[model samples]
Target: MVLISWYLMLPPPVFPPVKDASGDYKMNTTAPISQWIKFKTFKSEDSCKARLKKMPAFYKCIASYDTALKPAATPSTSTVSGAAGSHMQ
Candidate 1:
């Protein structure tokens, strides 16, 4: 039936939480396996490991930056002079 074929194409309703070789769940297991993006596909896990060994190790980290800062308050020189004159009087 068409329904059966469609169901087969759909991603599994439940996915057992799994982790990739890197031990990061978000990379390949957090989402539907079909929806997960692959950086590179290899014929086998051994080939992938071999290729990874040849490549330099790099860490991927997330960072956030905020550019908003409060402006500095400045006192005018005239105000100081006026206050000094008042005190002298």
Candidate 2:
């Protein structure tokens, strides 16, 4: 079996209250989600693969954020479709 480890750290920052679709102060992109980051260590390539397969939610959450802090959406349909296809698969 493969073995891997994970760690999550939230930076010490106060996030402003942001309104969601329901008009409630909830944590979303407008909040300090960037304060939260994940650090992972893999024993080997196989271990990383196993972790990704077994814990897709964790993988998705960690990979969903953009390092550049740019808007996640683009103004092009083709680019959006390509990105969507890559993520959905």
Candidate 3:
């Protein structure tokens, strides 16, 4: 009786949601971005970029996780560009 009552009172196990190397979690099917932005662990610049590369649209909604929380620099507007432009190649 006592053991049964104690078992019933115990709380369920709580597990931190699984996250990728960049600390981003799997996108929710029904509410993807809305749910993704709620995670607090992804408050780093690099982490945000990794997330962007994986799910760029997620960037449109959530605040930047950069050190300054500012938007990343805009990409070059050139219609034609490649790694060869700078040095590589």
Q: Point to the candidate with the largest TM-score.
A: 2
* Residue-pair clash count for candidate 2: 0
RMSD of each: 21.1, 13.5, 19.9
Ranking by TM-score: 2, 1, 3
Q: Which lDDT tens digits does candidate 3 get at residues 1-89? A: 22210000111122455666897564443332323333333444455456556543433324433232333466775633654465554
User: Against the true structure, what is each candidate's TM-score?
Assistant: 0.23, 0.25, 0.21
**For this target, which candidate reaches the highest lDDT against the unseen true structure?**
2
Per-residue lDDT value at 33 in model 2: 41
lDDT for model 1, please.
Answer: 0.38
Question: Candidate 1 vs candidate 2: which has greater TM-score?
Answer: 2
Candidate 1, residues 1-89: lDDT per residue as tens digits?
22110111112222466665787442222333343223454544455565556543431111112111122456989999999999998
Model 2 error, position 7 (Å)? 9.8
| After superposition, candidate 3 runs with Cα above 4 Å error | 1-40, 56-58, 61-89
Ranking by lDDT: 2, 1, 3
Residue 45's lDDT in candidate 1: 47
